[model samples]
Target chain A: MAGDGRDERAWVRGAQAGSASDLEALFRAHWARAYRAAYLVVHDAAGAEDVAQEAFLAAVRALDRFDGRRPFGPWLHRIVVNRAIDWARARALRREVLAEAAVSAVPAPDDPPDAAAPSAGILEALASLSPEHRAVIVLRYFLEHTPGEIARMLELPRGTVNSRLRRGLDALADVVEQDGEG
Target chain B: MTDLRTELEFAPLPGEIEAQQRAWRVVEAAYREREQLPRRRRSLRPVLAFAVAAAVAAAALSPPGRSVGGWIQDRVAGEPDAEPALVRLPAPGMLLVAAERGPWIIRSDGSKRYLGDYEDASFSPQGRFVVGTAGRRVTALEPDGDPRWSLARPGPVADARWAPSPGFRVAYREGDTLRVVAGDGTGDHLLARGVAPVAPAWLPREGRTVLAYARADGTVVAVDVDSGARLLRTPRARRVREVFWTHEGLVAVRTQRELRLHDRRGRLLRAPAAAVRRELVAAVPLPGAWIMYAEYDRRTNETQLVREACFGRGPCIAIGPSRFFRGAGRLRDLTLSPDRRWVVAGWPDADQLLFLRLPSVGKVVATEDVRREFDPGGSGGGAFPRLAGWCCARASG
Candidate 1:
């Protein structure tokens, strides 16, 4: 679903001009990764779909106001990741009200099997991190956003983003090593 | 340790393609349906001319216009008390209220948390959780507004009700199909196809999974979900609004025109003939075979709250004269307190909530400016909030 710079820019221009085909092209190019990033943060298929759907809807609402010269991917990704974080935070508050001690384990991914797939152990370890920590790791590694950009997107201090990335990576490493030992 | 970035870059997400297709369809539909905002026109000379002429005419008619407007205001505005900010509730339990922004959970001390963008919501049996629905998804949320589990259906979901404990079943309507899911969000299966849009009512008994729902064919049917057997099937009403399981082993079916009670075997148990003509708004089962209901009169533009005793063997007897809560408009969404001592109604026309203490002098406590209280930071002019439920006491912190 990745779109190259020229194609992405052209689609954004056409979409802003009210061309449905170009809008669809932009959606198709960004849908999968957007949905995946949201899924990783919220860890629920339905919630991820909702978060991504809301992000695209927000984009459409703001299309006329958007600057066509700017790149579209980071803008869309920002909305997706931020909404996913909000969804996860709301779920955490609900769990506190219910007095549940532990968040539910992440469900098995729906992706078809591939040799290059990350191990289930790593995915499980990723789920064990708080949603805030998971969001930092996802932005840094999956979305390829820099720490400063993530801090801006999430409204967090740059130092806080670095600390979360460090702690999240260390936790994932510990889980993977234990899985290897067992 | 391996580079964390390498592992994350290759992480797989389940149902990625299907999710994308589903979401894109919705997004594309929304985009196609969006109406363009109207742009401002550039000229104002003709508008200024018309406004000046109208202002001259208005001055000539000012005396008569003022009199007519004042008369209309007197007719529409009820006796309004000084509205204070919602600082605390008059009772002890939490209140689930639905405003235009979303559903909100208001604590006993009048603190509130907006439970994200849900359309309809209901409290779990013990007040431990809230189940909310939006679009095609039904989510089980913690009281503070976190999601526990969510199930997405093929159609939009509505009217979700969690069964009483051992709280195993949740029944909801998804585009005319009644679906039941296990309380923990597993074992979701179709209970009835082509059912009514009304929310299913579970029998309020311990360890029982019997549910009553309206069918598209107009009949109100009760079934035992565990045994897959129909417990009772009653004759159809004109337009069934809701159905409830009464404490006296009868099912109360409310249509727009009348309230009818049926026995466990589905025999029609009639109410007093005098109570038939008025439009039944809402009803709740009271202690000791009594039913409290609100009835509206369109001609007089008045609403009355009445209590009647129905023993299931004979016609319902009027317990006393109906009490009128004087208001400029209708009072709706009658919800009884957990202790069954207070009944709350939302008066949208007056922008207040009327609390009626039952079985006594019928003392009324009216809280004003309810719309602003529930919808903080909102326009204060949207639709009034509907009282979803008055839950039991919160667990001790």
Candidate 2:
């Protein structure tokens, strides 16, 4: 995962003992994936930053009590995805409130999120699915968590995770005609 | 389905690097504040025990109730890597400190000179001089502790704030009355009677002599000291403790319960919504249109610092309530350096003075045994010192 993740345990031990450099190494290793996974689910730049930052802060706070033997990635990813889903759900409710306020609250049609990029086509399609469905898809494909792991991370039934993954994939299957890189 | 990980990993996000830098600093600060779980170091335990035994044996021979443990801790209270003392400031400004002895002027090089006994002190606009008040007396001294002028008032004076650029006037509280004096400590006249116990703030606009003070009735008023015209006044608010004016023409009023932003017209502007059960203790306006504040949680007993960036003058647009520093106990004296690069405050419970690097931090410098530093000879170390203000090389509005 992050440089074979062999160093993760050592970094956690060092960070728990008041080593800032070890903490930085851990943060740098996981920040990208944590941020991107949150962005894919929340679909807002600021929202993703908040989710990822909050996840990192939580990790730092729990560093003392954390068991270094356990993997840090899954723990951090669970926080990221859950917070992102919460943020997306909150934003959805805010949209409904603004919608009731006036007709002008509606945004103009966006150009596929990032029109010039070919990947935006897939992202636009993913954006259409519910945040819960997006979380399962993101955890499965993006963070590379297995169905069992996703269920545990999200505290959902494995069957529910699989159903959301299937529905999410079916939605994006047409949008992305070609896919590359494992 | 082919893995979309490759695309998701590289998708462009706006301000990613900036956000990472900002978030890393906040996370790092929280980590630094945390007391790490004691790690097993069996080899060093004996050595530490010997040292502790020696100290105890030395203390046992001393007078009853006086332990050398506190004196020892007063010498080494911070991290082993922390600088033994404040050798230099991260930013390029001078800091004014009110210690148990008196006010001390600390230059950029970290050298300090203590003025003779005074209870409180504040820096002039350009760091050219200082005005110190001690029990029925107010004295203006050069940075080198030479008296430029001294005056005896009928009542004790404190919180003397010099007006903005060209720095021609100073405002101080005499008894319950507010008064303003010329920069040379002459032409002293009463501005408002029966003012609150809060410090007065000068609106930092060039060529403008707008002075803001809270009334006894909880009304905050900004009046032109020269023309005696009311610039702005707020509806009665309770227990106004401190008033801070910004260069961007916004005044932030901090009461016991909440901190709020008011524009030049005195209309209360919407602030970043604070969560329930959190008490707002202090707020200081930064160089840009930004204000940094500390919120103390009653339930958790944690203090959190938040930074807000405001745009426009009146009916301002507040961009963020971004989290800055979170520490145990309360972080008091939220003072910003002149360059807006560092926020210096005292963490009382930790007995450490925190110098929080602004915007973001790869470097967090804290001075330990803060009380002892202010109390040299280390008898036992007085209460923590007050960070008067961080001033610039020259005066500016």
Candidate 3:
């Protein structure tokens, strides 16, 4: 999201005038966070690409209706993070159904966060929490949005945002203190 | 030690550049296509524009944990507005949904009433009565969720079903033994032993006392319950899961990986070939010469609904399986409507009950918030409800 705001505004104006270069620049500017934010939320490489692509497509369709005066980062990210959450929730439910059919056990909530425990424990630990918790953590730390900004972006209460952040950090506490090599 | 932010930024995101290139191509293509379209007149007031912007933002940013209907408003992308709740079914009929707590009767008008805390239930022939099983008790209940009669077996009873037309007998399984009782809940007697745990299928013919069930040894058998006559017995099928009987006298036996159609006399007719990693989860033979089945891919986690047209009652012509309606996760319990034009499948992965329009996708109407709608005051986080059966085939109720 860090870029020249004046240039971003000009790029939006040019893209609306059918300038492919401006559209490409605008895309490159937002694609990283959109893709990374989606990856952190959904935790699938192919799915992250899909979420990013769909969000970009949606942004293109809404390009004409978009007001150039407004920032594009939040608009594009709104699509990416939301679709990622939907994808994750659906996967969780399907896993629960599989567990039920095979073992007849109630689904343990990820409310507090895979057997695929990777050597890279941060993403794995992030995956341990529920999708809602993951979304807030990604928005706060990965995307660097303020608590109030995250609350508004996710349509959640500020208290709810803080609580989710607390729980999410608690889940990641072990890996947090360790160096990135862990 | 670095904090979580640095670790995340440094995380090795595989195929980042390749993904960006692929995604950019798609984005640029969409951008170009939209650029070529004719512009629409935008004469809206500022207030209307802001409202539109808010709706778009709400739709795009809304968390699925809050509202799945909005999350998947048009999941497969056809409808403009998907109902957040089951306001009404697309067609006129009753639906039976078996949640973890109990079974419920959703009427044609979208009004629902809980039947009871029974584990299993199905409507009687005409949808006037329901038979439900819980623990060792099988109770017959009126349409209003009131129990009319119950018969307790010595062990756990399951898969209880009523006889066709006039409803003279009710057949159920107690442990591994198949048992039958009169329609009035009297004259309980053992029908067979060593029965498979699969639910028995009753002959759809009016006043017919013939029933087909799988034995524990994996053979499908049809018997005349009245005279105790063994009508037909097929060679042992491998991992037979279900047996379905059509009104036209054709018996379809479904196994873990294949769907085999057999003649009324238990002769092997035909079957769809099994594909690797693609397991046939559920299949049902619809009257008027059509068989619909749901298949799941173990590798991809995609559930596909395929329809095959039959040349006759016994064996189907190899017109090939027409694959239609593929979605994420497992789409279980394919229940056909009275007209056979609609197939309802429970998509628990998304908390969605999709009514797959028949003959392939003319339209797919979905009802969301099913967990909350069916679970009443529960946290909406319990086991996703199962579609027990579609009742009142003709909506006489």
Candidate 4:
């Protein structure tokens, strides 16, 4: 994590100066983690890609303004999380507009995500949690960020992060247990 | 314990990491391209101002000679580029896009001949005719793209809706009053006045229209249009949430924790405490006793649809997990088909649009092309409900 952060910072500085290669290097380095964070939160591959890309783009755009003192993962997570929120809000607005348009019955489902192969039921169970809880799980377990780092990234009290993590775990367990019922 | 923590420690979700890296490459390349440019001494304020001015101007000008139908065809041609302006609904074959700038149309077929645009586009219970707006301007054209009417009124158009018959209505807000106009922009009447209404929803099979307004206390008041009578005044649930009226009942996301449903008479419906919930994406009323609500399940990383009671007789029916377009994607802009059998979700960041079949809400029925129209900052058109459709009376003869 330390090496990744330091290397990412170097790339960030170069990208801020508009170095394409540096930006590419940074993308190669952090895209997997960023995408995983977004995918775990959104569970939609298309959306995950966009979120990950947006997070990187935001990092590059705001790189000049970046304090450079903090870890890059937290900063990037903040961007990805914020973009995800915006995506959620936009989705809600579109739904409202559609409802107003007088559509009856449920619309069809979305296309399935092209996962490498479906992960274990844990992935499915993970999908059952709320976005807030999912975020905590992703940050703590997936991204391996500390509760304090998550607090700083999400702008919440450390306690809130801990609670979200605890609740997320509980919820995940419940979903997995329920799945096992069948 | 299988150690969910161990699961997280595992490498990224398989191929997802590669896909994201590819996407990142695009953004990085684009940014690097931006950097190499001569440092623009000019601030972006002027460019933004110009763009805004252009959009305003575009809103002002009408699409020439093109009927609402033809305009739809022209826009459909631009779909391959991920056009932000054009969107196809999830039905077997339907497209909802800005055909000619202002008039949004729902096309049954890809052709413009099957297209209809509303002056004020509000869909009916079944996604029928493009319901015309009241008091506002309508760009009506013949099948050949000949302009038949460009109707504008003196007062601001408040709202518009289609009656069960071919008849439609539009309500316009003129100062403190509301002016209701028929679907064709004729037979104008003052449905209600002095209420200063915001969202006016028409009840099924009745002349009754419900007008919701913000009270001084920040609560919302649902008033009847016919009697100018206040039905139920409830505390404002969420400052930025949408309310729906259906034959089954009235449903809205009062808050993330509360899904409120009421009958036509405003009776209370069941409220469920969800363990994990994404924001309410969209709700589609079904033919019989169903209304499917789309939600992004942040927990499972899946988009979910829950079917609930419209008759106040039953609880929500889980339509089961839905499939999303991008592998491990997030839900963006989504639209449900009129039958509630299909859902279309958009992800602009990946420049992809998806249409999925619902109830058995799995499997992709159609995947179409999309073109990016505008770029404000990162993506001017990330998934917002840019897609819409309505049911209006079409001559069955």
Candidate 5:
């Protein structure tokens, strides 16, 4: 999730003390995974960028008040994932109102925008799941957070996190198997 | 079988590095430009706390006391020409104002009635009934503040707007999903899900129910609510804030950076070049295909209200000179009068409501002590009330 905890703490302390290099080091270390988690949930490149950027901006805004003893990844991840969920929910709402013709006209996520498109297998499977399920999976697997940790990060009950994980895994399995057969 | 964890852990996130590079620039710039507020010292905290508490208690106990006196002194000393209070509206219309207490309906003669504890509210097309939201409940209340009907959903309701004449529909957002109900509070159904927080704008047409709203993906879409037909979908804007259906059957989309106008068929019409790096705060469509917008420049801390009108066939012409409204802080919430004669803005720093005459700069009215005016009988430290809408010209009897 983040680099060495000791190093991260030192960076946080230095950044709070007005060290630009420490802040850059912190941002550079965490920006990739945060953007990845956001993109996995929102399924939009530009939106993921916006969500991740906003999260970092929020972090910068709250840097002075942040406690150095706490790890910064979970805090930043919480903001990124929540905003990604919001973005996904909003996208779903807009898609729901699309006329049948327009809905059909929109391209599927599996359709590659360019030759350098990422592997469509897992990403396409993940796209079938709702944003809530996507968020749980991203936190659990990509960020390597345990269910309890994820529950706390997401502010969801442990039981709810387990159930979401179970349901999301089942859905992903079905999509991957179907893609293999096809 | 592919391990789900392995697949997720290794799944390619295209453009990760590029996205980070771009985002870092913005984040670093913001970090460099942030204004650091001085932290209070621990030694004198108790004394400061006591003083603040006493001031708050004193303001609560007396109306024209210290807080109101400070507001008046600030206005009179700072702006000698500003009006003392909202004695009368510059134009004919009821105004929907939301304060700390709830939504209030102010008549043209400055008579106001609080409409219960709704978080946000709007007037029906005829100003006959007001639809207000409190938590998850959307209630339709008569002008007298009596509830005609209420619908409670699972999620918090917000951005409720009543469709224009033949006002049979009310569209509102309930926790990211857009739902529509009959004006009589029946046939409540989901119109769309995943809508941007921006309120859906109804095409002010008779005999048909069409609604335009921004999708989360940044596209603006207009759909026929009755037939479930997609009439138009404009190309995605980066981050859309407001959408308006203009008098010429065109849609105006306001993003953080620009204002874009599109026809009913989703063709780009015109986007006036914005001078300076000013952010668009609010905009309203005026009669005769004219538009007025409040744009704020962060560097100067000023908001300019500009009027642009499109005549016959040629290019849309900007009318007269843009009026500058300066304040110590941001001036926002530009609401036009029902008769299209005046525009009112909320200036929080000055604790005043500015009423500027339209078309050309005519008479300007600035009402002071707005926080005390809206949050009467309470601590005068509440946020300035928002000018939700200036209702239609007809007074409900």
Candidate 6:
């Protein structure tokens, strides 16, 4: 039997009983995983934090409704994932503006920052990917979730997730190749 | 050259995930502190007793049958209107609300010469008329605040919305039945009956309206308002928070997860199912596009902004660390200028407005203190957030 799972379940039970202390314990226990999950998708610290707290809050509200048979971590992780997706959709306009600004601010090939680091170039490439493609890469690589896990988390078919993982890898190869050329 | 995905797998860009977890603990502690009772007890028994005595004396002294509204009018009826405050319009003034306390129509200046209590108030896209509910009364008022007409419905009027183009229709809830009134408040037609819905979302391109009913377990039901024919029913979305119809199509923000975009026929438009794991504070639709503002990374205390094309095929843009502050608070209620040039970012807790020059190089252009009504740093303290809705007008060429 998983002792940590029992403790997590106990904390959830305590939270359901109006125990703020238990809720805080639960937040401390699960917040990092949730934030990491969100960060892998949005790649933004602030947005990840917001998603983590909201996910925790949602978990608290629905704690009583939680079937004790299942683990709470996955359920809470689902909330974080959903919140990040909504945030991505809502900020569509601001991202456009930021991308335009970023494109304009990007230095030329011979700029001073060009030789700063190969890693920066990789980041730029990752950032330049479509949110969907970027998410697939982040889930498959950054978060280290399997195609099956990603498919279940995203509510897509396993085949779709596998194809996306493959295509995402191909796109990443292109990006890294472009950076090497530069 | 190493493949980017291979390298990313080997070494993830450091994002203080552990620190963020610690910060979330602090936030959770802070909320618990607020929940702790007897922290501060400032009683008003003495003040309440004195106020009661004064009210009794005033009531005894006043003449009979003189209502409070009447008495106030008698005292200040002839007073000149107050000077109009030069408050900046957030979104081309497409949506206008009187500065007065009640729902009475005030001339741009703070003067309530006309008196009509609306349960709620809204301005048309042109700002040429007002829509509101006053008890069982639903009325449309011209720009001058004069009632163009009023409709007395069967149920207590719940909510009223107007479509910007192709004519206007108002949705009202009477008991459990939902009804729609025409532009003139006539032809009191039963659009869909037995729907205890919060509000109806008018789908773009199509005249069909989507409403979430208790029967649908809060899953949104899209129906053609004119014909009452059901168009589409969204799957049972878990913890569905908000559904908005953008210029592109219908977008539903399901809690802290994915923003599903659906066409009028309810087909998923995007592939790979793009998702963000942040709690979205607010979303503002741009001209043929939309912007989402959300809080990110608990410890870092930053927000993210995302951009998506609304009209047709275009790549989705995601901007992270949009704004960062020392303290904790989520971004709420973002207002894009009518021209979509400026964005007013509101933080309900901070009661602060970050006036952003649209398209800033991934950073806030400026932050301003505009928290007269909103408590910039208070926890769920005021109704300003609820009353802080904005409307965008198509730019006039």
C-alpha DockQ of every model: 0.14, 0.10, 0.15, 0.13, 0.13, 0.05
Worst 10 residues of 2 chain B by lDDT: B41-50
Each candidate's lDDT (Cα)? 0.71, 0.71, 0.72, 0.49, 0.73, 0.49
Best by DockQ: 3
Which residue pairs clash within candidate 3?
A113-A128, A113-A129
Candidate 2 ranges beyond 4 A from true positions: A1-182, B1-68, B71-81, B271-276, B312-321, B394-397
Give candidate 2's error at residue A120 in angstroms: 90
Cα lDDT of model 1 by residue, A1-182, tens digit? 56898998899888887788998999999998788788777777656766676577667656776788888888888777866765665555444433444433432232213233344777778888887789888888888899999987765689989999999989988988998899
Backbone clash pairs for candidate 2 read none
- B1-397 per-residue lDDT for model 4 (tens digits): 3377666656346456456546654564446544543432211101011011111122112221012222223222111212112222334434444321223333442222212323234444334344443344543343212344445766655444444333355444554555665555566666545543344445555454555543334344566654678777554454424444555545343434456665544555655665455655555566566666556556654445455544674555544333222222244435556455666665332334555555544554322223222111122323232454433233111
Candidate 6 residue-wise lDDT, B102-207, digit = tens: 2322221111122233556665555556777766888888643468989987668865766455446766666667777777778877766655445555554534
TM-score of chain A of each: 0.87, 0.88, 0.83, 0.80, 0.89, 0.71
**Runs in model 3 with CA error above 4 Å?**
A1-182, B1-81, B312-315, B318-321
lDDT of 2 by residue, B1-397 (tens): 5646666666676656766776676567657655432222121111011122221223223321033246554332232333324545767878888876577766654445556567889988788889999888889998756689988898888888888788898999998899989998799989899899888988877677889999899888999999999999987787788887876777778887777678778888754455678888777777777777888988976787777676643434446436756666677897888877788887665556777777643245765545544543223345668889889845331
On residues B297-392, what C-alpha lDDT tens digit does candidate 1 reach at each position? 776666667778888877788755645444445778888777778888887765667777776424666555466445432224567888888887
| Candidates arranged by lDDT, highest first | 5, 3, 1, 2, 4, 6
Best candidate, lDDT-wise?
5
Candidate 3 structure quality by residue, lDDT tens digits, B198-285? 9998988889999999999989999999999999998889888888875457788989888887786788777657787988887777
- RMSD (Å) per prediction: 18.6, 24.4, 16.1, 23.5, 20.8, 25.0
Query: Measured with DockQ on alpha carbons, how good is candidate 4?
Result: 0.13
Interface RMSD (Å), every candidate: 12.8, 18.2, 10.1, 11.2, 14.5, 16.0
> Which one wins by lDDT: 5 or 6?
5
Model 3 lDDT, residue A38, Cα: 86
Question: How does residue A16 of candidate 2 score in lDDT?
Answer: 88
Cα error, residue A77 of model 2, in Å, equals 56
TM-score of each: 0.57, 0.55, 0.56, 0.42, 0.56, 0.43
